[model samples]
Target: MNFTPLHRALGLPPCPLTDEILSDAVTSGVTETDDLDWKSELPPIKGLSQTDVPKDIAAMANSGGGMIVYGVEEHGKAATGRSDAGEFTEGHERAYRSVAVTAISPPVFGLEVHRLGTECRAVAVVIPASVDGPHLIYKNDFFGAPIRNDADTAWMKERQIEAMYRARFNERRRATEAVDSLFAEAAEGRDTVERAWLIAVAHPRVPGALTRLTRDEAREVFNDARTITLSFSKNTGIHPLDNVEYLNPRPGLRRWVAPNAATGDRSIWKESWVSVHHDGSVSLATAVGGHRMSSDGYWEGWQVEGRGVECAVADFMALIRAAARSLHLDEYDVRVGVEWSGEQPLSILTVDGSGFPYDGVSTPLRAFTSARSTVTASASDADFHRQTRELAEDCVNQGGITYLHVIEPLPEDEN
Candidate 1:
């Protein structure tokens, strides 16, 4: 439930945007900016397909994303009054999505459409700042990337387009590097014990304005996150924050660390921990496997339980969503990896009677394997589930477990 820039500008509450907020924005003399636009009305469905909806959306995305509010009359880019844009049905919302997809190139992801007011509804289209830009809008015979120029929409020139392409590539590289760095940091000191680690990291492209929190406040917010049951081949009830009992601040990293390191033998890598950063980033690691003892009690290679990986992914995604909400962030780039140290390859042990694994799935590992993807905190439950499953599948598949299905469809009511 990340609030839009417009919400911040208007000094409105961060959630449940309504007509009162819109009216307050107008009365307070709020005007259009590079990230905010106001519209008096919307065209008919046919006209909307060919009108400025796509252009405005593209411009906002290119200009670091913002909101386009309909039913707000404006003069000289200054808010004038609120007018009824008319009722927006589910079909109408779908029409807007369809137009954005068909009319814009490299369609923007994480677009949110909100209906405000009960009697006289106003529509708000929130576009996320995309790493996939520059997004183009096609005219009759030509296509041009639209950019927000001050308070208006403008076409991108040749040099601006080139710079955008460069920026896009750099963003991708940085995201990959960030994931690798975080994984390496978490994996440190693991060599002291024989264990397979599940490490996950969530990094925001444009970092949030999350201020530092006291250790007490940090503990309360994290512990309060809901523990939802993720249904896969089995039901794994996990909440990343709830897994750890002890919490302490790591001021050097500007984060709070919660680890269940064994008190008796600190060298043993039987630990589950989560690190929440001030920049709205989070890193979590949980040990799913330890020394596999033979019948004679001899140590064998690491054997990772397949169900542990599934449960870890479920907990990771849930915690990520909670962190995003707390920091008022929308989009994040996420990475997950499994690491173990040994000459022999790690084994993903299947349940004895589940029939989900075979002998050939376990192969020799060089060191570690990982997968990365992007997620929107405010996305629909189905999309969130799909993204989490895809990331988990990629990580497991790298270890030769191809048939792992980590996320199941949400219940009807939840959908």
Candidate 2:
């Protein structure tokens, strides 16, 4: 019933380890050998029967957090090379889940099943150390209690069982203390929007450089600014076009801009946008809005992906109209134009006599694109901006679009 019961049930730390880290652990001898578990001597069976697997599971829980790499060669020490690695053999994963749910004494949760790779040669199951100690594995006639001893599993004795009970009590006390501490820390900063922004801004899987901006500068660009232009030098690693900027107007009112290009000088080019929100949300809304608006003749003809210049212009106009309807703004208030030939990834040029520019404003128009790019808006504004900029640059480099412009959020006072 807690906020994240699944995570709690699994007894894993708050952070989820990356696939690489998990993979490395499995490959580095986490898989059992004959010297370790009796199950290892039983050969790499297609699937666990009721009897063979329960003891291994109990032993693993009693031992410590470790992995069981099934379908792997015991002596070869290599993966199976099957196409579906971890996928259950017909009823394997299901059987594992079902047995874990019903057969284990107190129940174990948070068992993850995943495909290793293209080759279904191996399956790995991570078992957490049981605080309850020495679990009984009852499968038909075979009944035994087992405990973990360092790297090996051993049968449990009466004295060992009693000691395990005492240890279990101690573990419960420690677990309660740890959980309380974690809850307190999580509660300390309840800024969902800010957290979401950070998630948005952070680099995706690939490594890249980071640039920091002061809070004062962020406020200056976001507030009292008619238009904000972002430029970035090209790099192999993706970089956000605009740096991180925070816009926290009031309680429950915040917006983060991920990397994006507002405009460029040329009428023909491609552009992209990415948005991140505080609650671990991400979206990738490309130049579809611009394409929609331009196609409808709401703006001048400009080059866009997968469409001719005139068609692109018509689409861009249609996008502006759509954004107006969705964002509750007037088409007349929205300014549409293009920019190019600047140091920035995308240069934004607002239409003259089209009312105040919403190019850089953290209004619903920009927010819509951000939300479209990364559907989660519970992230911090700064992080979202950072991510959006990077995505914009990536789009430009990939020939998606050349110019970026605002198509909605027309000023309230515009004609």
Question: What is each predicted model's overall lDDT from 0 to 1?
Answer: 0.72, 0.36
Return the top candidate by TM-score: 1
Error (Å) of candidate 2 at residue 279 is 20
- Which run of 10 residues does model 2 get worst, by summed lDDT? 198-207
Q: List the residue pairs that clash in candidate 1.
A: none
Q: Across residues 212-276, which tens digit of lDDT does each residue of candidate 1 receive? A: 85687566545543343233224542233445653553443688777664434432334677777
What local lDDT does model 1 show for residue 369? 54
Say which candidate scores most in lDDT: 1
Those runs of model 1 whose alpha carbons end farther than 4 Å from true positions after fitting are 1-16, 213-226, 229-242, 246-252, 261-270, 291-301, 354-361, 405-415
lDDT of 2 at 309: 21
RMSD of each: 4.0, 18.9
Q: Let me know the TM-score candidate 1 reaches against the reference structure.
A: 0.84
